[model samples]
Target: MTSSAPSTRIASKLGLSDRIFAGPRSRRLLSTVEAGLERVDAALVRELAMADSLANATSRYLYDAGGKRVRPMLALLTCQLGDGATDKVIDGATALEMTHLGSLYHDDVMDAADKRRGVPAAHEVWGNNIAILTGDLLFSRASQIMARHGEAAIRLQADTFERLVIGQMHETTGAQDDDDPVEFYLRVLADKTGSLISAAARTGLTFSNGPAELEGALTVFGEKVGVAFQLLDDVIDLSADPDETGKVPGTDLRAGVPTMPYLLLAQRSDTSATALRERIDDGVAQIADGADPELLDDALAELRDHESTQATLDLAHRWSAESIDALAPLPDGAVRDALTRFARAVVDRSR
Candidate 1:
């Protein structure tokens, strides 16, 4: 799994331009993620081959838009850390990533997102029906991989998948309601993002027959980091260059999804959020390009300056610290450092 350091292109993109990890150890962890992608591709191949021509094109569009494949990497790293290394464990890692990608395929349709990972989304290129079918196929393949392990792994994966779907539905409900509290948003993020990451780490433990206590600790760590990740993503959406984020800014705002930043801003303002929403609806038709751009920019600036952003960052920082602490009890080595650095890396990611 070990290999050389990342290229300058990767280093710059990952915000590792400085000596954050700063040594050979960081390189090995990065190499492991790259290596995991190779395994993930093999699983993706089976799903893609089973799809119809249009579906195949849509699936391939997503495949070509390479991502970090963090879920699989998490499984692999944790497996090694727990003194559990086997083909089954590797397959488990692959399965987790497949499920994650599958959900993204569906999410694009649900989000009506035109792009993902800087490329056109599958649903945008292909019809919604094909996009959904492709996602179902991926989900099936993930299940097949899980079944190969045993009943226990199969059950875990099944339960996780169920939770994932439920989380998606919960988020949709919140968006439709439009007045959801920040706490509800966190709950949706946990079920949607946290459960999978928690399962990945726990799957590694299952392979190793590691202590129950350790598994529970890692579960907490995963949930917290998952929440932190989404918060940072929201923060980035409000501030990062559209080119860098690979999406339109104020997208969540436009969709009327009450994210933490927006919720925070509304809380600070004298006007009620419901009243503000009504105004936006009424005013949208009349907003001139010149006037609207300036107004939107000012609103975004205020949202960024809201105490909520700092509060959210503080929470992210603390959770990342706790993630490292949970793994601290593991034997100290480059493997441990790699995971810790990964947690730190997520917090500081530029895009």
Candidate 2:
């Protein structure tokens, strides 16, 4: 693929701007992240290739469609605190991104999602078995990449993958009878979303020469940011334009997937909330009985405008704020400053 010059738009994707990464070195830091992302993008394309034409096409499908590069950006940004995108750092970022891409295939299969990244989901195009295999193929390749970094990296990848699986399992199974649904769901977000992000930052630090003291802080920061990002996604799921978010609104509700808003709404006993809950439940049932999800568009719009949506956004903001607080342990520097901007960017994406 031909490359374009790194522009302000690319930097903006990571929430980087002169105002945020400022002082004499601000431009330098922004340039570094842009350059690193370019390299990571190129590396991802090369690594995703295969001997079979079908495997190659399936692998590159979503990559070509486009993503925000959030995981790789986190990896690249954190690695800057150390050796500034060394070869190992680039490799780590590439592997981490592959892990994320691979997971999406499986997620789409599980969600039975029809579209992703603005196009047909792999499962919709290739069938669930093929889509699942494609996802596993991506994960296997990612594992091979991590193996090159030796035992510590391998173990880290394993632990991260474990969290991803466990998180999905919890989400699929729902909260236990004894579990606090809200708390349980937040933990699921941490495991499913936050764990991989946390690993990306940690892997970057491991591959580079970042200080040991920075590890704990970056880990907390990455995971919390992950949870916040997902929570924001819950809100977004209810309010998308389809043109902008590349997703139909209320896909979660249609799937009977209980998002933050659904859980919170279930807890409220007020008249409006109860009335809204009844409408949502009926919508969910209709979808379950094979009704088209679009039929429930009116109800989703109502839920989106309800106070529960605001409550979900507030919860996301809280997680984002906590992620920023985790950065306090890091030394005052451009990296920390940029990470603060990045965390805010995750929450601000909803706007």
Candidate 3:
């Protein structure tokens, strides 16, 4: 189905959790997230302006384009749901968002992306070097913010940052050779996508001093949801409409990133498999003309049918179940329910 299509009925049976997408809980959490995102945008604007006037203007230009700000919101809501009512979470959220933006700025330069969030990328507005410097500055500022807190918070943020860097390095270094397996993809995803999520949830538990059991459970939940999220991203990268995805289709294809769909398909087809390895080593054009579309479709179908996707779903579901059960021993309230649903929603989101 196209990206904007109201998800296929089949996804429901696949155990894609929807508990977080229903009722007043979802609405309230969404409203809270919106408010939190606005605050984050304002902070980004203020900090980007910390540069000289020209740099400030360029930063503002990047800020105006807008984004989902999902990481920060996840950090904030998880903290609140865990009964941690400190403004420190907001500070943490801002730091996380800044770090995320910094990564995107650098990623845009590396990817040679011209636009993001419907506007020119940082590298497009400023030169690549300037964008890289700005990203560095943002990352440094994030650590500074985290450092204002006690050692525990500082250590947590530091660990999360390490994971983020490791994930990026792994992605850049890993060869998409024939020897690479789907498990490698999962590891890459866990670090790249899961680290921030794990940090967000763990921050909540830490702030609240929630049960120790909840920490591992929520971490698992975040990691599983993160994997599913990235898997869907890889899927959408191949199939999503340009308008919805805010980028060109076939990005992974062009980049020679052997995403899950293609990897799964390669496992089953000799010619397709050989073409995949060739595409990784050379380029997608190596595939015979008219083969690209068929191969992409077959890969997508294989992804849909593969045990890997189900395994991803199972992991996500297990975490959701654990997150809910972990909360069962806590006080019954809207916040707890909202938190539970939020975890459920993490895996259910289409975009």
Candidate 4:
């Protein structure tokens, strides 16, 4: 089920190799996607290379660290429904991936994170001001690429960018007094993660002239899959070893971020919940004040094994299933099958 060298990392990282090469048709599709990804990778290097040496180096930092390239792959996969990767589709894919990479720089800054893709975060290396500017540069470059595709692409890019900002704003502000914490968290996930993913899939279809009728279904699929992907990330935050996920376990908890498991725990009124709640509340404050690492580690271990974490995993599976269901309207073929497999793989991150 493994692939050869270059695409092997992407396929293994995403657990997509088996599904992608499952059948002869799927193998052909995989070859096509790998080829497009190669082009996208080249474009990433060329696009991020700026006349300003500092900007170029800073912007290229995360790109060189390596990522799963899921966004661009989603864009490429959807393009198979119509004509395969045309020049416009490749440009759109490149733009979408650039947008994703830029968001990571800003995200690490916002989270005060130390590492990304196994390297020091851009902010950690170059300082917040330089890191923020690098993100802006990449974002502008993405817009410039979209602009070449015409007004519609520009509008889509603008709208997606707006959603991304609003999502971060809501996450920063926290849920309002009357807001349902779970519902609010889901909305934030949709805005921050799902919106851009929907745009990525739709952009491929738009650029490659995929069937107009399937646009709505693919959009729904992308958004749901994106939410599922992030929810699984929430579970992974608690469960995955740092080596596996490339993130410190319980990083969100330490930051006082409201992950799905935490939000779910907040809703429980039973006696069993009281001790965990107290531990979390106290642990968060202590970690913020540089308290005992042993205490925080113990609390995180308990929370990771808690029922609430399992519930979050269940929700992720539900979303993944719903995403696959959205693909029901598409014809039965390799593309549809791969999309379904992708949805399942998105949730499978919990393993």
Worst 10 residues of 2 by lDDT: 1-10
lDDT of 2 by residue, 176-246 (tens): 99999999999999999999999988877778888888899889998999999999999888875875566
Candidate 1 lDDT, tens digit per residue, 100-122?
88898898788766677787778
Q: What TM-score does prediction 1 earn?
A: 0.81
Q: Scored by Cα lDDT, where does model 3 land? A: 0.62
lDDT of 4 by residue, 171-285 (tens): 9999999999999999999999999889988987888999999999989998999999999999888764776666677777777887999888888998777778888889888
Question: Where is model 2 more than 4 Å wrong at Cα?
Answer: 1-9, 12-24
Q: lDDT per model, in order? A: 0.68, 0.83, 0.62, 0.85
Poorly placed runs, candidate 4 (over 4 Å): 1-9, 290-295
- Of the candidates shown, which would achieve the greatest lDDT relative to the real structure? 4
TM-score of 4: 0.95
Q: Give the per-residue Cα lDDT of candidate 3 at 48.
A: 55
RMSD of each: 5.0, 2.1, 7.1, 3.1
Q: After superposition, how far is residue 80 of candidate 1 from its true place, in Å?
A: 1.0
| 1 or 3, greater by TM-score | 1
